[model samples]
Target: MYKSLRTFSFLFGYLPVAAMNLKKFQAQKANLSKQEYDALIHTEPQKWAKGIMARTKSRVETSGLDYLPDGPALLVANHEGNFDIPVLLSEIPKPFGFISKKEVKKLPVIPVYMEDMNCVFLDRTDRKSAYKSIADTVGKLKDGHSILIFPEGTRSKGEGVTDFKSGFIRIAKDAGVPIVPIAIHGTSEIMEKNSNQIRPGHVTIRVLEPFSAEEIEKLDAKELIEKVKTTIETEVQSMAQRKADLQ
Candidate 1:
């Protein structure tokens, strides 16, 4: 309880630092190459995320990070909680962005921030807009950027992963990029399971094998998504078992 409150206060404490860094990134966005831009922009946020987790006396343990490809690839992960974003920023070796709802576009600085960070926005209610979103994502990927998507479309909040939406298949197929499956566990315990409170918890991030673009090109949509889902599910179950064993 006190930990959560103090953590929130620490977050607020960092707002000025975040603002200063965002301003710097915004200014540098045009001059840097994609790789340089990703590496530069993600540094501060990653540090901030780790700081927040540390303040709560929480930790993250990750494995199979070598599974991440050096080239562009679509990162697919199970949505467990809000902390998933912070966890990824803190743990993943490389920088990546995710699709956001257009509703966030209305916010003041966010849209620009997201744009500088290589994120895209779409209106879920509009079919045409969704298609455009996919096309835009494909274009970015082809331009040499990696993207992370939560195919479940909603957080399971540690209740076990739900069914994945099929849109990811189209993104990978059209972009000609590989699909990297990431299985994450225990983030929900830090917030969602604690009644929105922060608590000390260990989160696990397992970066499973990637399905190469050649594999993406060969498999049908249904088969591909099924295979990806099964891979993530199997890893998540194994992560759960490990946590239980240490109890």
Candidate 2:
């Protein structure tokens, strides 16, 4: 209970002030390229997220960053916990946005930051809006900003990865970009599994090699999705087993 309260207090206390500063920065740098603007806006939020993870005593280890190429690409990962976003933002060297649920756009302070990062919001219940969101994401990718998508559509709560929703493949294909598969393990153990209370834990994020546009085009959509899904799941299960062995 104390940890939850502390986490909430820290987030609520810091965000509004941070949002104000970001808005000033945005207005002053209105002419910056989208990528430049996003990197600038995300600087503080990334720092804040890393601080929060530290406060919770969570350790994040990332691998295979060298495999991420320059320019635009689609980052697809399994959904495991609420901490996944922060962990990625804090650790991943690239400055990128995400495909977030539309409801997140309604949250205080956060929406501003996401917008600054060029994030696309999807309302799954509304097919029209969802499709529009996907189009917007593709445009961003083509514009040279990397984007992250969970593909699982929702968190698995550490039960193990769920089957991915294949629609995001359209973004990569449409943008003529590569898809980088990422597998994240042990995130839910930090907070989601125990009623959202923050705690000490270790998280692993592994970035697999990119599937180039040429490579994606060689496979049918089903084959492509299955290939990426299998790659991520294989790594996730291996990481989970390693965590269990340490325990």
Candidate 3:
């Protein structure tokens, strides 16, 4: 009963904070141009995420950021917790965009805000729509925008990454951008797979080296997917082992 109350209190507390942030975002939206709006949206979220991570008593470890070069690249990471996206978006020092589900477009005000911030949403159930979305994402990359993709399509419920889907590789190839594999750990434990109550925990993000577009161009889609999956698995395992050792 106490735990349930705590959860309820947390949700109530977070909702208002989210609303205020959104309100502020809406008020400021018209003052910035398209580029400025994208920049602020990306940077402000990182600040908000860092504050959230700090409040939740989480810590992040990163590596291989130097591997990201100037201009555009595809960032692929393992999704474990719902919090992972905000965590990554908070710290990654690049003007980046995200590939999100089309269903989010139905979200009141948020989708309009996302559109203003230049997020690309894909409709999974419609083949033609998905291709059109992919083409739109590739165009954004061509316009020199980096992007984050969880090739696993959804969050993993436990240790180790699920088999990667090939769609991201297709996106990277079509966009002519390099793929950077990022491995994240501990976020699931912070909020768990199905729960919403945020717990104080540490989350580590391991940014592996970027694989150049030129490098993967010769490899088939199947081989490229395996390579990124292996890299993320290795780093995520290392983080898990490190957490276990500390315990």
Candidate 4:
């Protein structure tokens, strides 16, 4: 009961302040390029996220970043917790964007920040709008902004990952950007699906090697998708298993 109340209060109290921040964000977004916007977001995100992580008592250990491409690449990961998105934004060093659900655009301040980061929003229920989102996302990628996409589209609690959605592959192909497979584990332990409580926990994010766009083009799209999906799942499961073993 206390946890639920805490979550509700947080939402209600933060909304109005967040709205004001959104207006400030909109006034600034027009003057920035995708990279510039990313820089702007990160300027204070680290300090802010550090404080939040401290409050939530969340710990994140990242591996394989050394293997990631230094250039623009599509970043794909499994969404697990409500906190995972912010965790990624606060942790990942690259100037990246996210392909988010349209509902997120309705948020008070977050959508403005997302837009500043060159994030694209898709309405899954509207097929046409979704396609337009894909097109716009590809354009952003082409303009030199790497994007983070949750191929599973929604949080899947702490269970195993769901099937990869193919729409992201089309955007990657269209943009001719490399794909970076990221496997995140233990996020749901911090904030589970359908719940807002921030439980104390640790998470792992593993950055896999870049799979080149040119490499994907030679093979059938279906085959390429399968390969990437298998690789990411395998990595995520391995990390999860390792974490369990340690515990």
Candidate 5:
């Protein structure tokens, strides 16, 4: 209970401070272009994400970063917990944003940062809006900003990965970019599995080799989705087994 409260306090306290920083940034940089402003402001959230992991006594070990090619690419990963986004934001070497739910746009300070990061908001219930969001994401990708999508659409919360929704595949295909599969394990143990109480844990992020645009084009959409899904699921299971062995 105490740990949960501590985590809650930290999260709530950080918001107002983040909002103040955003205000200051906007006030002092009136002439900056949109891209320039986004690039400058993005560092704050990256730093904050790292700080959150550190404060919670969590360790994230990553591998296969070399597989991420230069230039804009689609990063597809399974959703595990709230920490999944933070972990990726802190660890991914390139500057990128996410395809988040449209409801996030209604949030206070967070929406400001997300918008600055060039995140696409999907309205799941609105097919037309979701398609528009994907088109917008493709535009962002073509503009050289990487985007991460949890193709699983929702968090498994440590129940193992669910079937991925294939709609996001269109972004990479339309943008003529590679699709990089990422596998994450152990994040749920930190604050999710134990009822949102922050705790010490080890998480692993594995970046699988990417499928080039040509490769993606050669495969049917369903095959491409299954390939990525299988790749991540295999790695996740391996990581989970390794963690278990360590214990």
Candidate 6:
């Protein structure tokens, strides 16, 4: 309870203050050099994410980072919980954005920062909006920015990983980028499993081998989806078993 309260205070207090600074930073975007702007836009999220993880006393460990492609690639990850994003941001040594639900766009000043980071807002209920979001994500990928997507469309909030939707496959094919599969386990224990109360948890992330554009183009939509899903699912199960064995 104490940890949860402290984490909430950080979110509620620190974010608002950061927003004021974000506005001033954006206003000066035209004058600042690209390096200066990029550093802040990317590092700030990592800082906030690490802060959140620290406040909760969570431990995150990642492996297989060498599997990452040399250039921009679609980061496909299964959504495990609310802390999943923070865990990735803090652990993955990459500068990228993610596909966020439209509801997050309503949050105060957070959306402004999300936009700066090239995050896409997805409206799942609105077909047209969802399609537009896909296009936008592809555009960003083509522009040399990596983008992460939770293909499950919603959090499993448990040990199970739901089937991935096929829409993200289109984005990967259209952008002609490699598909990097990521398997994340144990994040939900931080919040979702505790009924939204923050708690210390161990999160393990594994980056599976990436499929090149040539390989992705060879498979049918269904085949690609299942392949990526199976790869991630297998890793998730492996991580789960290892944790259980330790316990």
Per-residue alpha-carbon lDDT of candidate 5 for residues 125-180, written as tens digits (9 for 90 to 100): 99999889989999999988888999988889888989999777888788999999
Against the true structure, candidate 6 has what lDDT? 0.89
Candidate 2 stretches with Cα past 4 Å from truth are: none
* Pairs in clash, predicted candidate 6: none
Q: State the lDDT at 135 in candidate 5.
A: 92
C-alpha RMSD for every candidate: 1.8, 1.4, 3.5, 3.0, 2.3, 1.9
Per-prediction TM-score to the true structure, in the order listed: 0.92, 0.95, 0.83, 0.85, 0.90, 0.93
Residue 188 deviation, candidate 1, in Å? Answer: 0.8
User: What shift in Å separates residue 9 of candidate 1 from its native position after superposition?
Assistant: 3.1
Model 5: per-residue Cα lDDT at residue 94 = 69
- For candidate 1, the per-residue lDDT at 189 reads 87
Tens-digit lDDT string for candidate 1 (1-247): 8998888876668767777889888688799888998888778778877887888787789999989999888999999998898889889978887898888778555466577668889888999998898999999899998999999988999989899999999999999999999999999989999889889878999999999999999999999999999999999999999889999
Candidate 4 lDDT, tens digit per residue, 149-226? Answer: 988888878788898889888988889988898888887887684365667678888888878888967768898888
Give the Cα-based TM-score of candidate 1 against the true structure: 0.92
Candidate 4 has its poorest 10 consecutive residues by lDDT at 43-52
Error of 1 at 62 (Å): 0.5
lDDT preference between candidates 2 and 6, better one: 6
lDDT of 5 at 200: 73
Query: Judged by lDDT, which candidate is best?
Result: 6
lDDT tens per residue, model 2, 1-247: 7766776788778887787888787796868876677678778778878877777778888999998888888999999999999899888888888988888877788888888787898888999998898899999999889999999999998988898888888888899999999999989988988877778779999999889989987779999999999999999999989988988
Model 5 alpha-carbon drift over 4 Å, by segment = 23-39
lDDT of 4 at 157: 85
Candidate 6 per-residue lDDT over residues 1-247, each given as its tens digit: 8989999888767787677778777887898665456556877788888888999998888999999877688999999999889999988877778998889977887888899888999888999999899999999999888889999988998668999999889999999999999999999999999989999999999999998999999999999999999999999999999999999
- Winner on TM-score between 1 and 5 is 1
Shift of residue 215 alpha carbon in model 2, Å: 0.7
Decreasing TM-score order of the candidates: 2, 6, 1, 5, 4, 3
